[model samples]
Target: MQLIQLNLKHCRAAQDLLMQTVRERGSEVAILSEPYRTGNSQGWATDRTGKAALWLCGIGAQQMCDIKAADGFVRANVCGTWLYSCYLASSLSLESFGRILDELSIDLRGHCNAVVGGDFNAWAIE
Candidate 1:
């Protein structure tokens, strides 16, 4: 399946450009973080806080086995493989980040084929 991942940064222009590019590239799925809420969000699977979302088109939606959304994460099972879009904000405390990762790891432990992509905000200070 053709999938593309990006961080929209809540910008409408970036969102537009991404959609146009997705169409041009014939991408079947879009995994995004920090998306613009004012834009089209109809059938997307979005996190509780709307920090993460993923759009499935045509066969991508049909192949979905399970879907789950959390505060900073959105996950979908497509074609028997798990796809995850996550946003780990740099402002969050280290303990909180560790907890979130522990939970996600527990879920991932049962699956073998998986792809994870997103902005963890892990850029170095130096």
Candidate 2:
């Protein structure tokens, strides 16, 4: 399964770029962070070919698990695996970060397989 992680910066062109990436790379799943959500992005789950669907958080019920949406995370369960698409705030304090971790741990309870993906805002200095 091909997964593409993109940071849109809330740009309109980024949507087109996302589609292009999907086409060129044959991506099955897209983990978009900071996507430009003007209206409801609920329809974005489906590809042009209708071969795949995007299970956004809080939009609707997915296959096996109920998708949940929070301030910085969207989580869903596929079969038995938990998938989390998250965006961490850059200005978060140490205490706040720890709190988020605690909350996430609680959410992940009872799930054996879990995948977390998104723009973590961690820059690598060359």
Candidate 3:
């Protein structure tokens, strides 16, 4: 299975670029941060149509697995593999992010396979 991760900057143009990449790469799962939105930058904007975002074509509603989205993360369970899409703001401290990871580790205890991807612009990867 192919997984793709992108920071879309919450714009139509970015979403389009994501789609183009998806097509070119034949990605089965996409972890997108900062998808299209008009206002609130505090939360995610779920493509309400159930598929596609702004101008980007999605994997299609019928093709989607069990997915859930919360404040700083989105998750999907597909065929025994769990997908965790996380986005941490640059302003959020590493300690706080560590706490979040701890919580997630607990939640992921039983899962054998998981794909964790996202934009961690907060960290300086030395």
Candidate 4:
């Protein structure tokens, strides 16, 4: 049930650090955005889109949805809870982010117990 989310900024060293920390914390899942990918990371669930990745340490997950960069999201069912990892690029406008949110909600329609995590660079500080 424990989850940690991080924006690696595409650093290999950061990926190593993240793995170490996850194991030390005994976290069941790690949600990553902008992960550094050389080829296929051993435990991380990577998709063709490559915007977000999910790692399940000891727990098994059943994927409910396909990972896509168009919405920047990946979904899986973990022990009855719907888990999602998403990433929103800073270059995208708030409206785009909102649109993605709407799309995600559509995918989440029937799932009551769901957890969504990711690095969203979009923020309204103005």
Scored by lDDT, the top model is: 1
- Displacement of the residue 106 alpha carbon in candidate 4, Å: 1.3
Per-residue lDDT, model 2, residue 71, is: 52
Note the Cα lDDT for every prediction shown. Answer: 0.79, 0.59, 0.59, 0.74
* Superior candidate under lDDT, 3 versus 4: 4
Clashing pairs in 1: none
What tens-digit string does per-residue lDDT give for candidate 1 at 1-126?
888999999999999898788888888878899988633544478767788887774344455547888767878887777988898898988777878788778778877889888888865657
Where does model 4 exceed 4 Å of error? 38-43, 46-48, 59-70
Candidate that would win on TM-score: 1
Cα RMSD, model 3: 6.1
Q: lDDT tens string, model 4, 7-109? A: 8889999989987887888788778888886335444565346877777764445333433334677777666777777888888877888898898889889
How many clashes show up in model 1?
0
The candidate, 1 or 3, that scores higher on lDDT is: 1
User: Model 2 off-target regions past 4 Å?
Assistant: 38-65, 122-126
lDDT of 3 by residue, 35-89 (tens): 6643232222333222222111335332335555554565666556777767667
Query: Candidate 4's error at 54, in angstroms?
Result: 1.2
Residue-by-residue lDDT tens digits, candidate 2, 1-126: 455666677777986777776778766556667766522454343222222224333323535356666655666666466666666667767676667667777987886778777655544447
Measured against the true structure, the TM-scores of the candidates, in listed sequence, are 0.86, 0.68, 0.67, 0.78
